[model samples]
Target: MTMTVRDLRPEVRADVEGFARVRRLALPFYLVTADSLAYDATHAHPDSHYRPLVAEADGEVIGTAQVGLVHDSPDPGQGYLNVYVHPEHTGRGAGSGLVRAAEEYLAAKGATRLYAWVLDRPGDRAFAERHGYRASRSAHFLRLDLAGGELPPLQDPPPGVELRPGTDFADDPRPFFELDSETMSDEPSDIDYEFTDYEAWLESTWKHPLFSPELTTIALVDGRPAAFSAARTDGGTRYGTVMTGTARDFRGRGLAKLAKNDSLHRARAAGLTEAFTGNDAGNGPMIAINKWFGYEICATEMRYVRELG
Candidate 1:
């Protein structure tokens, strides 16, 4: 049996479904769907040269890789290739082939530094190291039983602040976009990102298939968005918090906590049973907040970096 790596054909539903299946099997903590896969492939910035590659064995996609440059980052030459192979296909050379093809593609596009997330398993770590990648920072995948766990009682907003759903801003979401951009600028990461592209954000985030605007909670200060907890659902009982943050000026006022609590309560009321989220290992404030909400660390993955000459 031979495995060959090739560009993913988004037009082919089977290819996208197979790629998403491998990702779901390898990383169950995160959300992945056919629509999301196609969106990422189609809506990616052209400057990034984003390419989703799949390893095919006997006409079946056994492994997948999302390869692209960090176009939104302030720094250049940074690229990423997140590779996932079906657990059943692990012993084969599919994973290696996918990574090699991804690296070559990014290198040809002028990427000097590459990063990938490797699950914190021994074999996964060893594979990354064998390819000259060194582990940098780590992050955890957290899960909460929204249906059974006890969540903090929802609280009314303080004076001058009011809680609203993301859908409330449907007529004009620029305010939320501004708030998101400000909060995201401070997120900890190896790559520096600037969310100055509002149009792109609208198409990619606000209009995403999984984004649950009705379930997302937003805190408004004098009718302006000050903090928010974005929610995404898989059109089923599974829900996830994609982002929860407060504006810089609104920090320390517990607005973020207030927003998240409201969102979670709404999720439970809407019949969602499971909730998931992720946090960088060093983000103490968010970690503390999640822990306070009874979310348990389910799994961890390490970010590995490699340099190409």
Candidate 2:
């Protein structure tokens, strides 16, 4: 079987569909659609140097790679290549071929440090180690059976606070952006990210194909955006919360929880039966909140880093 790696051709519907299929098989927790795949390929920031690669074996895509520089990171020369091979095609050299192509591409573009997320399974960890990558922080993918599980009953907002759908800020999302920027700054991450480009955020995040403004919930304190739970959907029944955070001044008031609960209920009512989310292992507060909402640890991934000359 001849296997080759090449850049994903978004024009070819089959290529995009194959890439999404491979990703879904490898990372079931993620919601991947052909439209989202094409959007990333076409709309990525120029500074990101993003390239989506696919490994094809006899006209079938068996693996995929999302490779790019971290344009938002304060540190330069940092890049990432997240490669995933279909479970049924694991031993066909697809994973290695995709990684090699990604590494060569990023290296030529002046990337000196590379990072990847490998599943917490032993084989996946060994694969990264064999490639000279060392494990760093870990994160977990959590799942909540919205259809069968009992969610915490919704309650009226506390005095001076109101719950609103993210769509309420459609006319002027700047307030939400301000809240997002502040919360993101405090997020636990290996790289420090600064969100100073409002237009960029609007183009990339606000207009993203997967972002669901109607399902997203926001908490307001006397009309001031205090916390939010951002929701994303694949145009299907699957729903996920990509981010849930509270403003610095609004912490410890359970506003974050309030927003997330509202969002979850909205998602369930919208016919989404499964809910997915991710959390850094060190994010104790968010993890506890997820647990309280009946989310269980479904899968784990370890961050791996490698350096290049």
| Residue lDDT tens for model 1, 61-124 | 9999999998888899999999999999997998889889999989999899999999999999
Residue range 232-286, candidate 2, lDDT tens digits: 9999889999999999999999999999999999899999999999999999999
Task: List per-candidate RMSD values in Å.
Answer: 0.9, 0.8
Q: What lDDT does candidate 1 reach at residue 188?
A: 88
Candidate 1 Cα errors over 4 Å, as ranges: none
TM-score, model 2 to reference: 0.99
TM-score of each: 0.98, 0.99
Which is the leading candidate under TM-score? 2
lDDT for position 58 in model 2: 94
> Model 1: which ten-residue window has the lowest total lDDT?
39-48
* lDDT of residue 117 for candidate 1: 98
